[model samples]
Target: MSTPTAGQLALADRIAHGGPAPVAAISHVAAAAYTDPARWAAEKTALFDRLPQVIAPSALLPRPNTAVPHDGFGKPLLITRDADGRAHVFMNVCRHRGTRLVEGMEAQYAPRLVCPYHAWSYALDGKLVGLPRADSFPGLDKTSYGLVELPSRETSGLIWFAFATDADFTAASAVGPDFDAFGLGGLHLFRRHTHDVAANWKLIMDAFLESYHVQRLHAGTIGPFFKDGVTAADKIGPHQRSAVGRVAELAALPPGDWPALRAAVTFAYQLFPATVIVVSPDYVNLMVLMPRGHDRVLVEDFMLIPEAPATEKARDHWQHSWDLLDTGVFGGEDFRAATLGQQGLESGAIEWLTLGTLESGVRHFHEEIESRLNTG
Candidate 1:
């Protein structure tokens, strides 16, 4: 379909109220950029390869009865608590010669992780404890041989880590004034889910950008609230927040609460890499899109509600909201398959693809990708 010109967006707002949304037309962007192998190669090296894949240490917040995934390569990483009730993230590796320090699911709040490789060990704080044959490496200074430590922090109900090695972490992460202003930490963990999808990482982000697909892809469910051509966009840091107001909430909104009504209206935050943070009046859904490769991506969806619903009635209330989202936005299998098939275009199969202006959100996404790749 041909994309609409920039001029059509204003009209799209009106069409979403009643008329059909015309196909989008995009300029100042190109389709090959999102699909090109050469460009993809450049992306991996230029920006992504240079950026650290680690998160802040504090992001490992587990629910009262839940355990965070602490998978690691060196010394099995351990995330547990001590008697003091403080949470900690530590390496499960031995201090002697890089042996794994701990194994298995639950290691008690032990002060030290003993290495079975040579009976060498490390304190829970990562200090070198002992070497069964301490004289074997006599000149070795045990203090300098502690397990590799990582920098970390916790915020907004999630743990954030700096995967990059001493790379001025403060500037690399996206936590700052804007996030504080939004008061993201106020929300609580509610629910979570995981989905393995067949598409480029960006395709997952694109799935939530424009409301245009709702009328067609989700005609029976979420369609009534969102329509083609009706949405707004704003970018902060590396995150983009797009929103479309819903009419369903208006019906029950208590008298004269304009501010609350506005707050209840939309889904926001399409953060970089692959994280979609949906903020609603009742709950918060944070979706992490982890790229497996150029064509395979996995989405980890975590819902943070005002509180976890232990009762069935409360659970249903939370499910009702996400049920619409699951079948509607999360159901992008067919769309992704189509994009993947386009990979054949590189083989002289097709000359070019198109983008509609109404779908400029997609264009904006590519522009951001291009900017990062080129500048990095």
Candidate 2:
């Protein structure tokens, strides 16, 4: 494992000393923020569309000449790595007749993308390479007709893209060094599951931003493994990074031992806008929350491990971790709570939701959103 960052070590030092997690002033957010359609529309435009968004982990397209289709955010996108080992993002539609070029979510060894409708082909770098019946279209320039490319960057073992061509990606790049310390780019994709939750996207993101709900909401599943309401958090641009776990154990570990520290505490990251990375002792979970509407979200959950299983025992161990997180902890607890919260907020029983000091991360996340929406 890579060595821990100074920030991580500082958090551990605080935990060892029994220092209280930093607290924020009590705050409240309008209930309409989660229930109003207009607010949701504005957020999609200002945040999701304008800001750089995570496309997928770099491990998804593990090698050159590989491709995958992504529509999790409701926009058909194709992610590819060229033979020269460069990553690119383009509209999934074929330039000829606008037919969807790639159909599935799994990455494949695709040297070139071929349109199923008319056999029009495109290179991994989005160049239109071949087409049938060249005489049919005289003076047609293939170079000018390449797939529509989007602004994209591959950093810290992840792929990020933006809808706007002029979008600044500095905020997304800020989190790369920390992620690299966790070896995120070299991990293996163990499993992936999709959840269509009846809740706003922010609600789902709010769940990961704070550890206040981990003990109570997940009491039966993952609660016992974590300390009660003890967490340390800071921000990287609009992104929030938090740590929660056995404080005593973390405090006792020798300094600079990140692997041992990881085994004692769980690190969670809420990437700006709507992506989450949870680093557990043995594996990492990436959750991409795509807002479908004011009251709906599509969550793509991925579990990544250090390497492929080499034995049946290894496979069993990884399978157990996957089941505990994907099926029990997140699917059963976190998502269920988000959907339930949505139902209550929609009933008009309350005008605003009170946020306690422990939920400061959630409030900070909202403030970040408000800053962008008001300015944009």
Candidate 3:
């Protein structure tokens, strides 16, 4: 049995005492924060554009010469691994006419990035290598026409990209020790689901930051398995790690089993700017929130396991977990509520959304956003 970390031990102690995580105060944010176009624009400029975002798990591009195209935070991004196994990130557009590159090519490995428009080709490392009728455009400098590179870094099995080309990024340090402990890179991507929610991206984030709604909103699925409104919240820079205790199961464990105490809690790690990485006993669920508009967000859900299930029984178990998430808590309850919340906020039915002590995670998240928005 492995010893519990300071965080797990502290959380277990708090749960044993039946105390809620410490809170500052209840807070409120304007309802227009969900429906106002100007507010959303400000968020994009001040928050998303200026901060580093986890765009993908490093496992997604595990091999050399592999690439993935993304439109994250409204910016076209192309992430690739070169033949030498180095990661590269670029503006997913051709330098010639700004044509979107790698539109539908899906073989997982590309010898070269070929623009479908004029056949402007680039090497796996993003250097411009080919162009049709090269002599016709004598002034075209191949050296200067490479794909536009974006500031990106990979660490702890994740890829992070910032909109600014010279953005300062420290992926491992930003995520803290919790990231390394999760063995995130060791997890294999078992399945992925994409969702478009009809609510502000913040609303989507709010749903995962607290368990206050687990008893009320997720009563049918995950609620009964854990305590209600009882959680331990710890901050990692702008991020947080929140844990809810498993009352029934923990009580069943034998006394003096210190290591087993760690297994009796479920953790949700909020990766600042917009991702929630939830650690379960057997698997990990990474949820990314990207705003499509003021009242719309695109969510990408990735389910991961230590490895691909080898036995029929193992496969069945994972499949059932996927089904539960797809049909219950996430797809059914949370998103449905977010859409309804959007409709209400857009209809001018509320002045401000209120938060209580139990909902301190939601409050702190908004405070972080406000803090970043106020930064230069």
Candidate 4:
């Protein structure tokens, strides 16, 4: 399988959930998509430059609620559900004279966005409602002077927004597997932490696709359980699935444990670009890595339980699992080394980070990025 056929390659690409190539000896060349800054900028500007299709609309959340801060056009946005209960996302800035509209997260849940600078006020839906100096702009239409509204909202219990004008706007559909495959949709946000890792976002994503690092990078903790091979792979569409496990967890495991843990588990369904759901028997975790730029990456980690995990101890156990994962994920000196690699990229580092023969998960990810960037 030195050069896996295109169909086989595509299958493997989807199965390992777009991880780099696996160790079955099958091989293929994966195009590197992030090496060019111009392309990266184009992706950021074209895909994330307008309304985020996944970010829910203001009308989605429960009423008597204030718009939570979410990513919109690379800025922190606030959506307020007014007395009428209509949800609206407004720039945290004031429209009058270019002043910031809102200052902090949910501050006072103000009836309307009012500029503390000069006391100019706008309705929750971004309509200009009042101003101290009403006479200042005699002809300015309040309707035309509302706050800046970025296309966004909640969908399937997750915060998604669009900033890309050229996007397909079918983010939900683009996410390959339905909500069921990721075992999400009903999962609420149970935990969150952001990491400002110093690496290209693509690097961060690439790092997650393969298990090669587990052997050395996570040896002490989780490395021993999950081996270096992928158990199975499947692609339902844009979403890819991989079943992975370890010898210790699987030895003598009953066939019934397959859903949660039968010595193996469905590693996750990767929604290309930046979303992954790793499911275990007791809980599920969502890992969202958003690129801030070439050197700044934000990894927002979330944990959720299917039905409260049957007991507090079980819940604690799941949290402990995440703790274990988070530790191993951030553990060791890999991050520092990664920074060095990034620096080397500027040093005219090797043109391409070799995909090696075994890291198929990474190759899949890399290939998809290329598809997104080059597809007509």
For the record, the alpha-carbon RMSD of candidate 3 to the native fold, in angstroms, is 2.9
Please report the TM-score between candidate 4 and the true structure. 0.71
lDDT of 4 by residue, 1-376 (tens): 0121233233333433444544544444322344456666866754446325333322234455355555532676766676776555666777777866666533245566567798888767777889887787888788887777755444444555555424453655544233444445555444555556677766665565665676787677766666544555555454565556543444444433334342244455665666666665456666666777766666656667554467788768777876776555552344445566677776664565676544677677666655665752
Error of 4 at 228 (Å): 9.2
Question: Per-residue CA lDDT of candidate 3, range 15-130, in tens?
Answer: 65666547477788899878899999999888777778888777777788998887745677788998898787788899999999888523258779899999999987899999
* lDDT for position 339 in model 3: 95
lDDT of 1 by residue, 314-337 (tens): 889888776656544565433444
Question: Cα deviation of 271 in candidate 2 (Å)?
Answer: 0.5
Stretches of candidate 1 exceeding 4 Å from the true structure: 1-25, 28-38, 52-67, 70-142, 150-153, 166-183, 227-230, 246-259, 319-328, 331-351
The best candidate by lDDT is 2
lDDT accuracy of residue 70 in candidate 3:
75
> Which residue runs of candidate 4 sit more than 4 Å off their true CA positions?
1-36, 50-64, 70-73, 79-89, 105-112, 121-130, 133-140, 174-177, 180-183, 227-230, 236-239, 245-264, 305-322, 331-337
Cα miss at 266, model 2 (Å)? Answer: 1.0
The predicted structure with the larger lDDT, 3 or 4, is 3
Q: Choose the strongest candidate by TM-score.
A: 2
C-alpha lDDT of residue 249 in model 4: 48
How much does each candidate deviate from the true structure in C-alpha RMSD?
Answer: 7.6, 1.5, 2.9, 7.0
Error of 1 at 240 (Å): 1.3
